[model samples]
Target chain A: MLAKEIIKKIKDAESNITSVIFVGCGASKADLYPAKYFLEENSTKIRTSLYTANEFNYATPKAVNSNCIVITASLGGTTPETVQATSKAKSLGAYVITLTHKKDSPITKDADYVIVHGFEKSYAEKLEKMIYALQLAVEILNQFEGYANYEEMINGFNNIYDLIEKSAATVLPQAKEFANSYKDENVIYLMSSGATHKVAYSTSICLLMEMQWMNSGSFHDGEFFHGPFEIVDKDVPFILFMNEGKTRPMDSRALTFLKRFGAKTTVIDAKDFGITSVISEKVADYFSPMLISGIFRVYAEQLAIARNHPLTKRRYMWKLEY
Target chain B: MLAKEIIKKIKDAESNITSVIFVGCGASKADLYPAKYFLEENSTKIRTSLYTANEFNYATPKAVNSNCIVITASLGGTTPETVQATSKAKSLGAYVITLTHKKDSPITKDADYVIVHGFEKSYAEKLEKMIYALQLAVEILNQFEGYANYEEMINGFNNIYDLIEKSAATVLPQAKEFANSYKDENVIYLMSSGATHKVAYSTSICLLMEMQWMNSGSFHDGEFFHGPFEIVDKDVPFILFMNEGKTRPMDSRALTFLKRFGAKTTVIDAKDFGITSVISEKVADYFSPMLISGIFRVYAEQLAIARNHPLTKRRYMWKLEY
Candidate 1:
């Protein structure tokens, strides 16, 4: 019934919806990755782009139109840029969809559609819940766009929590080992591609840098052979996400190179996680990043503990004006 | 005459080109940034996306079509991925324009248009020459697309060499000071937005990480506040690229925060250079990255000298097979 209702409203807007833009800030940026992946890979019917709330609010790329659909997610729903961008999108006559943990949050005031989830106990929980909300929107839109694999995702959607829970349980020991081995390292490089690239990027920024106070950056597997791979040596540590998708070969190339160079490499492979049991094989790739993100949440926590830094501890985040 | 010849061919194919994708690897990735900026900001007539040659060759985004025009650049033109992707673009029935330092490069064999520049004696010269070729294509395409600012860019094109040469001279002292002050630091953060964001990203990867063997990553200025800023402490150094563009306010916000937090900050502002005198004020933003990049090449060289690392030194790049 909920999906039908949302689909009906989108159908009513179908004539006017020429573009779709996903806007978010901070950890909230990770929440919209699924929708972005969906729109980019599946939606040949509409123009799509994702932007940080700050960029969206500032220049407002010419992609936004009077008939555009602007989707934003903020866990606290009080991020200044996301709220402001929501208002700006509204003023531009674009339809706004705001996802938040709080039903009556700041962004809701300016959004046309508001999806709220129950309370989250931790940042990881918030991310998982928000991703679920965003992916639901993606599947509905995918069905509308007549993607052949829509049913696979729709069926798989029902078991997302199960898949993530199972994935976390299976990945915990490996994650703990990873955290213990690399906790003292000053810098780390993460590599992945396709839908999983967001997880590599966001985890490096939000968890490694922000939570654990470690220096880290994510490089696309496809672009790894470019200048970024020059940093590879026996002394450097690499964390590669090996997903079972079209982009898997790219990651494999990076993994082979890192292994050859004797770089200390840790792999988080989606194939080992039993994703096919929970999701259709056809759409398992679509959920690889979500599953990997679940595994990484545990890794980040263990990393924080091993490094003697609390995930909640921050030098400037909530304590200062920045 | 070269511009006219290229312009005529593009004009003849203009009706077929509904999309333009810029593809490259390593430093060549920086060449297409101007074309991406032009299309994203100035052209509602065509869809544009920038992709690494690896990604472009592997999972070509749904955007590439028979009606697509793909532009790619490689200095040596020997990068296997770039050459392969150029061929793949041609196979897709997309028009391919390849820029290289060598007139008889590998990619030239697969391209519809091959633009070559003379040999460069230094890394900085190579970048300048590559960017010149790429921007020439962007301006000519802009003219075909009826962008009003195209004329200004055409006029300004004649003065780019002088502008960059002057900008390099003006920013040299500041760059040397930056190199001297931060040579010992292993990790640094770079931030910029809009057209300059590519410069920030590329400089960090190519110059600081690859060439200088230092650790660095770039963040979009608008996304700085989200979570990456949490890593900022008084000890962490940040290089901020401040351009006179619509995204200036976003960078300003981050700069204001960093200044208040007392972080070591390096500011490379376009306005500090004489770019406005070399180009029309309306189109000066288009040249901001080019100017800043010229300044950074000197900074990177000085940094390599201070750190006792040669820019040509590499651990795995070209030394190992991936």
Candidate 2:
């Protein structure tokens, strides 16, 4: 179904929806986070949760019932755990929506709606899963509980793809530099807050660790002062994502600490890429992840090239039953 | 206030409560996860959230209101972020409960109730913050929506300290062995699911990285298959916490893959220490974290000793303000 059609269906059923749950595995799970975070931050009446697919199935929340909306995704739509989760949520009478790059896959079989996203297309097309899930959150809040920045969100979506493409091009030089400098590092740590937190996470797990076989970890920038800051030292490589949102102070604080401690750091600020140029400041934070998603894919590709490793290389995934 | 007194007050206000929010930092934040997890798994009516203290203050949830219960903790009760969060929650009309080891700490200033938890006395005493928060969850559920395992939970709590002590003793030899084997390792990865997920997380951030200055990362066992498992290979050191909960199968599956790949793993199973002997099989999952918390402290202490690094040793914490 088209994204607009999906939104229309949800708008028709908004009165019965009391909660939203996002579930997937790996990158898909990480990608769902922005949508969950967006709904949690804005909606006063709707409860939101994000869980890895298997955990959602194994320890299903009691809130997964007729009143809940479950948004799930799988790249190929064949992830067993996610498929099972879709079936379970459907059985529990949740309005299940599944996003995938393949049409009519197993995951779509149990979903109330299926959005076949694109990968080998434009940057915005490639981010359909994240964008669609995020749009659903925006529309749900706007229709059900009322959102003040609804028009701004819609405008931002219209310009986000072009903005992301332009941002990706602007960051290519730095991406190459980062690839050369960080390719041989023993371990890399990523940190971010607000909407871009899961962008850093997916970059760490899927792009860096899985693709490059490098040790990586990601933490919320808000958590830096807690215990994670203890790990900083001279020349310690760090990647920090600074948001253009209410939590931006947390990211800036961490950056100041990293610089003061002489740690080698790379800062990916949404403001640096002119995110606010197209996205209204009122609703820019929710669109930051879409820009970061496009920009980081360029970075990850450069890193793969620098390390002489293809993004498709995998040690155990799909080569064996795991 | 005594734990029972706190429970009585919550019971008195049960009908007015619609949500629960747990906030703290570092170890305290980590300790609050079990309560959040427990409430999420069992409560259908109440919404629950856990956040780092600063995040709670910066981007306060809109759900904080007269109908919300906020449980926050800071060991010394002087963490600026947590104190501010306590004040913020109170100002928003949420019933704020503060837990601290110091009676008149700053965090207690705006709290509706203050529970001065004990430390430096006994194993169970050191875990008062976690226990009290958990007990509050149990009581709230029992009084509000009703829980079938209430008696078992209370019984488990009564015997938990003794069970934890016994479990710590049983794991002493292995802790020492782990200290010797893992002392020089560059990075240690920990994994668990359900109730024990944050136990592994706290061990990584607080014990391993902050205390030992070793690189560390932790992931949920459910997420291991997603992207984290790519880093698993021969001799890769992992500390896996296996729960006795509904999600135990997730941990077991990860363990099987780790063993098959010849990855060095230290499996800490709640059943190993006879947790079900004291905690009924039905409620054993909720008690697994308490047992793991005590047992892992022993393991962390052993690692500290073997590395000649005291747990109190710090590079920048308290010495310099960021």
Q: Pick the candidate with the highest TM-score.
A: 2
In candidate 1 the C-alpha lDDT for residue A46 amounts to 61
When superposed on Cα atoms, how far off is each prediction in RMSD?
Answer: 2.6, 1.7
lDDT for B16 (candidate 2): 63
lDDT: which candidate is best? 2
Over 4 Å off, model 1: A1-8, A14-16, A43-45, A118-145, B1-8, B14-16, B118-125, B128-145
Candidate 2's C-alpha runs over 4 A off are A1-14, B1-14
Q: Any residue pairs clashing in model 1, and if so which?
A: none
lDDT of 2 by residue, B168-223 (tens): 87778999999999999978999999888898988888888788988988888898
Steric clash count of candidate 1: 0
The TM-scores, one per candidate, come to 0.93, 0.97
Please give, for residues B58-160, the per-residue lDDT of candidate 1 as tens digits: 6676666677778888888899999999999888788788888888889899899888765456434645544565564565566556667767877676766
Report every candidate's CA lDDT. Answer: 0.76, 0.86
Candidate 1 lDDT, A1-322, residue by residue in tens: 3544665687676654556778898667766776676566555446566778877776776666666778888888888889999989888878777888888899899888887764455433545544565565564566456567767776776776777776777667877898899998989988898778778888888888888778887778887877788878886988898887677888899898888878899988888877787778777767788777777778887888888899898877777555
Native contact share for candidate 1: 0.56
Per-residue error for A222 in candidate 2, Å, reads 1.4
